[model samples]
Target: MNERFNKLRQYNTSGLGCWVSLIIFALIVGKIGLGGVVSGFLILIALFFLVPVIGFWGFQWWLKQKITQAQCPVCEYEFTGLKNTEFNCPSCGESLRVEGDRFTRMTPPGTIDVDAVEVSVQRIEEEN
Candidate 1:
């Protein structure tokens, strides 16, 4: 989970870097009077925003690929969602906790046991 989060973070950082550089490049071109060319200006505008948007969407898809479904230890209910520190069981209403890649049932009163059962990761089929 941490690895996936780090990968997404790196993607976001790179996207931001690209956006900044493109903005700078656009500013330089505008200062040099290339902005007078409508086509060049339009292309620059598109690149200044479009590249980061595409990158963000691609990273989102990658992040979704890394997520796997986890079963509720208390109710055996399966759930497909992002990794979170805590979540409620859909079937039993039990609070569930996540540590690293492991999902376990949280004890009542908000306490986590040392011997919590480990939830298995269910494989997700990729769509074309």
Candidate 2:
């Protein structure tokens, strides 16, 4: 039941805590000189906006690194795609499926037709 609360307990800092801390710090520094207040304000803005923006782009770069490159099995045309993706080969127009670092022909969807003999069911009276 405690799992509901302690789900790894991630730091959910959305920069507001820094803003509050800087406001208090800035007010103290503001007593010293106007320059200190201005510098604190600049630092607060940089931390609030620039930090998250840089982190977002950095995460995107990390994820893009995982999207591997593969080649079309039929035409040998190389391309990049996410794992287990199926798409048409851009160079040859052949349907291709990707898995891990390699590519293969996409198997056609739907069940195969099977020829079978039809059987008739008859009801018989059971003797006691």
Candidate 3:
């Protein structure tokens, strides 16, 4: 996943979707109890579109903010905002795009690099 998306994941990890869904279900049940089938159905129909659309858009905005705040390690160029596609650094002419579990431009030459150190820590912890 991209570092930008990772940031969004941080924001949304509290399970906002699940909470909203539960609330909607509760509201639907309440409407059914008070106003009968017709009223319940009407509210459900409105919420069906409103809840998911707003939730998705909010998540998108959060993700976009994360993308914009990221700086290219090679060039130190700041992204504008809401990048719908991959971006390259403007200063050093290096790719700022993240790939898989690794940061492309940020990786170093030696085996004692950050990634290697993380792997070493995991390996040692697992052994213990």
- Candidate with maximal lDDT: 2
Candidate 3 to truth, TM: 0.33
Q: Mark the regions of model 3 whose C-alpha exceeds 4 Å error after superposition.
A: 1-35, 61-68, 80-91, 95-104, 111-128
Candidate 1, number of clashes: 0
lDDT value for candidate 2? Answer: 0.79
Instruction: Give the candidate number with the greatest TM-score.
Output: 2
Tens digits of lDDT, candidate 3, 10-118: 6545788899998987897776664575776899999998999999999998885555456666545665533444555666776545553223463345634233333
Candidate with more favorable, higher lDDT: 1 or 2: 2
Residue 58, model 3: lDDT of 99
2 or 3, greater by TM-score: 2
Candidate 1: regions farther than 4 A off: 1-39, 52-56, 59-62, 65-68, 108-128
TM-scores, all candidates, are 0.43, 0.44, 0.33
Backbone clash total, candidate 2: 0
Residue-wise lDDT of candidate 1 within 1-128, one digit each (tens)?
Answer: 67888876754355788899889879877777664667677989999999999999999998976565878777678886467657787788887786556567766676655566899999999999
Poorly placed runs, candidate 2 (over 4 Å): 1-40, 109-128
